[model samples]
Target: MRLFFKKRSTFKLFLKLTDWNNLLNSLTQNVIGIINSTKDSFTGDGVFENKERLGFLLKTAEEKEIKILDVGGVSTKPGFKEVRYEQELKRFNFFISNYFGKFKLSVDTMNYEIARHALENNFEIVNDVSGFNDLKMIQLIVEKAPKIILVHRHPNSSDIQEKMNYKDVVKEVRDHLEEKIENLISHGVDKSRISIDPGLGFGKSMEDSQKLFDNLEYFSFGFPLVVGYSKKKFAQNLEMTHEELYDHCIKSGVSLVRLHIAS
Candidate 1:
């Protein structure tokens, strides 16, 4: 199904297409299927570089009736070097030209340019792992006010690195996320266009990541949360399957999830 989002004088007008209330009403019992459209995702599910046809994968996910589709162009796994801008846009544009209009789509990118392109070309949301650091990124969201998934991570580090140091992991996370949220609002972004992701594997240690999941309720901050723990080292240590962990997040009030498998 195609989504219709029109920009108007008001920010709330653009939110009409987020399937926003669907996220709210399904918080207790649903999953947002993720499709890593990149070449080298951490979980080995990326389809962009495989010999298989991308259409087959997209068709399969649609057949499964997945509610939302999130596509990322670059691997966020630690130590994966940054993708050049041209290459990133090439992957994103390929998928956008073919499959975006057919799903409740989210484009995952940290780059302002890619996000801007997606926003203009009808992608319904931006899953921003960089916390909207760029002024243009902030302006795009504030002006166009599309849905966004704000992931929590420090600005000082890359996507993958040594375990970050945090004195009080839970408190620090709340402080950091709150600051970013407030910053976006101060710069004119509507809070309703925002969703929170604790970013389990981005830069946190096993313990810190676990603590955030344990206290996931604390960061709700009146916004829907998108939780992802699949293939995480900390979750591996506990031996919980992806579904088990997702069920737990749902029970703990998670509104959406990012996954390696869209089906």
Candidate 2:
């Protein structure tokens, strides 16, 4: 399988590959854009709940040639309200059909039913925030879509401040991901098709988050790294502005940075 990258004005075009394993091993920088589909997103850009606004955003992303668009219907931030499956499915389908149907789509969900539905609708990736706690969801991915992203998370924890306890932030996160990777491999998921995320603000405190970012090299884990630190509470309190944060992310060797600000 061969992958080609072309620059067309502001958009970048990524040609599909017949062999996904080879493509994943290739050293290439890919930019993934996130669409905040919930009103309670930590980022202030929750106004995108409007379909028209979402359409415009999608058009702009296509024009810019983003490699992937991750649509997240549920907000996993601290103190987030529990969103029902019905509501999530409604938003999920709407965003997929209206904005992401023609592009490479990734659904940000931990529910088995939701992930299965998204995969059935041609979504190429799954962003599981629960770190594959749902055995059924893991089985579905292994049996159906072998390529999926497994994020590290502290199960049964909701508050960010409470989940920051770690003997060694970098080592613990890496080991946790390695364990998950081995589990997936044992279950028949291809190692080349897997991606790992450190989950910066998911359940970490400001200090732990800083340590994770500082020790990013230690947690490379032989897979693509995705760091999502856009507009998080830690950034909001920092002396730097959003633009500065974006520049910081770019310099941090983060393969993909999920941002809420307009690019």
Candidate 3:
């Protein structure tokens, strides 16, 4: 696969491929396009409402040369309505079946069944926002040997909508990622095969989420760090435009920044 880079007036961007084994690396351009396949995305960019929107977003992603896509079937915003597994499967399956080989794919799911199906269908990354709290999810990752993104969700709540208090957001999130990384390593997964996500808005209050983002580099524990702050409420509250937020992420030296369709 060819990797395309956009030229900046100040500097020329560069990318390093991992022998075609994985599409992600620290040197990769810092944007991973997002595909919200559900009907109720907070960003109002869900393709379920208008199928034509998916085509438009795809065209935009192609124009931006976004090679890696992070697709989520259900919304993860606070107070999000729970979606049935079959409903999630329909949306995810449609995209996977039709665009399997067009771009590198990452399945954003907390369900073991969905993760398993995606891995079986050749998805390269499993982005479990629940931190792989489910043993079955970990087992599947071990069996499939696909790269995984372990996100920092508050352990006290199973639902992403529930907010949890944090004493020190940075240390707590860092500790959570560290523990998960150790667990994956102990299970025989290589260090390079795993990535960490700060999980910006899930289970976090707006203040806590902003604090976490401000200290994003603290969560980087010798592994690739992935951050998903695109279209988040906390980001908007800060009065920073989307371009400014993305620029902040790039300057933070993160491996990947999950982004939404450019509007």
lDDT scores in order = 0.71, 0.68, 0.75
Error of 2 at 131 (Å): 0.5
Quick one: best lDDT, which candidate? 3
Q: What TM-score would every model get versus the actual structure?
A: 0.84, 0.81, 0.87
Model 3 clashing residue pairs (backbone): none
lDDT per residue, candidate 3, 1-263, as tens digits?
Answer: 22233321232223232422245432245667888888788877777645577777777787776777888898887677778999999988767654533667889998999988888887889998878888888888888888888888777786766788889988988887787788877877666677788889888889999998898768645666788887678887997766667666666656678877565
lDDT of 2 by residue, 1-263 (tens): 11122331221213232333343333233456778777777655553358877876777676656657787888877777778999988777767666644566778887889988988888888888888877898788877854577788764455332465787878888888888888888887766667778888777888888778666666554666677766566665677655555555545544556654263
Q: Which stretches of candidate 2 lie over 4 Å from their true place?
A: 1-29, 47-49, 155-162, 237-253, 261-263
Model 2 residue-pair collision total: 2
* Residue range with the least summed lDDT across 10 consecutive positions in model 2: 1-10
Q: lDDT by residue for model 1 over 1-263, one digit each (tens)?
A: 22111111111112332446555443322455566767788877776754254676677655555556777888878777889999999888777666632667788888888888887877778888777777988888887788888888776664444568988988888888888888988999877778888888778888888888888878766777788876678888876665567667766766676654433
lDDT at residue 11 of model 1 (Cα atoms): 13
